[model samples]
Target: MSSDDHGLLPAELAEAARPAIAEARGKPARDAARILAEAGLTGVCAQEDDGGMALGLSFALAIAEEAGAGQLRFPLLDQILLAQAFAGQDIAGRIAAGEALGVIGWEGARDGLLRLSDDCDCDVVLVPTGQGADLIERAGLTATPTPLLDPDAPQIWLDVGAARKIGSLSGEQMADLRRAGEALYGGFVTGAAANALALSSDYLAARVQFGRPLSSKQAVRHHLARMKLLLEMSRAALARSLARDELGNPRDTRPAFLGAVGNAIWTLEKAIHLHGGMGFTWEVPLHYSLRDIRKIETAFGAGRLARQVAQDFIRAA
Candidate 1:
């Protein structure tokens, strides 16, 4: 969000995706993402011919960061990242065929039956009920029935089993996918903070106060300055991760992930604080930006990621 340090996005992809997003709500959103994911992004894995993207994590990452900036949400990262966890398998192909909806349970971080867990034009549920982890299911998914904080996102419930669907991905690979998802999610949250910052900054600049504009006040200036710092840091985090991913270096990802989540959390939080009272109101989308970013930070495991990084460093010593 901050110009202090900026990362580049794929202009062609973003431009192409705009119309698709404009027409799509929920199901349509999923479809467009699937199309993009299945089309050329499959190479993200080591073996491109094997339904892997082989595109390197950085390129895939650029897509994620851009998605975040759009105020758009879709399942591209979830599905592709999960597909990588199933390397050498036909999972990506199935997703391409529209047989599978990219989904996973966010609670407890466990795998299961995935009953009626998917909705919005998806063909399958993929739930975690009393049954177990099931990759395939036609129906019998129940709706969680929440009003939904995100218009683009809806909630669902389903039965699930304790375990199953573990694939060729070794523990390391599985861990990598989880981290990748977290990093991308963090980038998303970062984008939301950015969108809010832009809007808030513009409003403050034009609003007259104390015979001039709030911009003239020292207090407001300091807040805006910090906001700028947050945005720059977010960009740095995102760029670092993307470069590491592109280099195919896993070691570099650790700090990258950490910084991404941290940047987003602080960036969005600062935006809220800067907006003052208006930021808290429902009419203002700033609150939603904060909320959505919080969800991403929650998934990225702000606390867990920090702990794991420290633990890894200790063990390495």
Candidate 2:
């Protein structure tokens, strides 16, 4: 019965997310992320001592779905979850205290080089690149506001010398953290896709087409069905991965993680296409959600997921 509640998000998480996204629409998602840290919603996968909500991934996925539907750009999930995965520690309270602002850039080339604050939002940055605090001492970096397709855009500039490694991750732990980042990142995309579909659905249901509601069109109904299918697939993939983690099995999470990325990528692409010209324009917000999903898709190598899928197919064959 809350204004924003449509069953995609839990009552409390949905409420918290809606306002935080509203506040960030003016500034940046980084600015809105403070609410997540304060609410203890960011590090949902973190340990008890880590100042996290200690919530499970299914709940997180549900929240992500609503966030996407709203075209919300808050970095609560990205900053906090990535930070915890990087450090294996809960620093949400530090983030809430404003003593630190967490930001992450996925380091694909150097798995050993931990770039904790490459976004440089924090006063004391931690990097697995090296622990000399050298990254902190680098004063010649600038932050740039990179406007995304959405109103809530965040951008940062890193001076080449502005980062250094503080620690290293190896073996299974390293791989697990990487999967964690991909899964969480893709989860946000799934959320965004869900949001776009809802927006489109509402518009279709109300706006007249051929002297009737767009939803009355058989073709329109099909498009909506396709969107829902993709959305559900992404949600289930994320859920399965998180459930595995809950069951004390981390090894099989990668496929579920990758499945989400692939499903979200396809779903958002369809959403934008179905909305036609309006989806391309800034006046309509569906593009924002689509664009955000694309951003995460590219960052997490969604384009390459087909190869992984094919390999799995071959293995099964």
Structural RMSD, model 1? 6.1
Q: What lDDT does the true structure give each of the candidates?
A: 0.55, 0.56
Q: Which candidate leads the pack in TM-score? A: 2
Q: Per-prediction TM-score, please?
A: 0.72, 0.74
lDDT of 1 by residue, 1-317 (tens): 21211353344544544454433323464566555554444234324445554544555565565556655555555665655555566665555433455565533224432322224544433332233323444344434533354444544444434333433344455456655666666666666666766876887788787778777888878877777787777667766654534556654455665665666666666666766787676677676656566555554446776788889889999
- Candidate 1 overall lDDT versus native: 0.55
Residue 74, candidate 2: Cα error in Å is 3.1
TM-score, cand. 2:
0.74
**Residue 267 displacement (Å), model 2:** 3.4
Runs with alpha carbons beyond 4 Å of true place in candidate 1: 1-54, 83-89, 94-99, 106-158, 162-168, 242-249, 252-254
Q: Best candidate, lDDT-wise?
A: 2
Q: Can you write out model 2's per-residue Cα lDDT over 79-107, one digit (the tens) per residue?
A: 44544554433344455433356554444
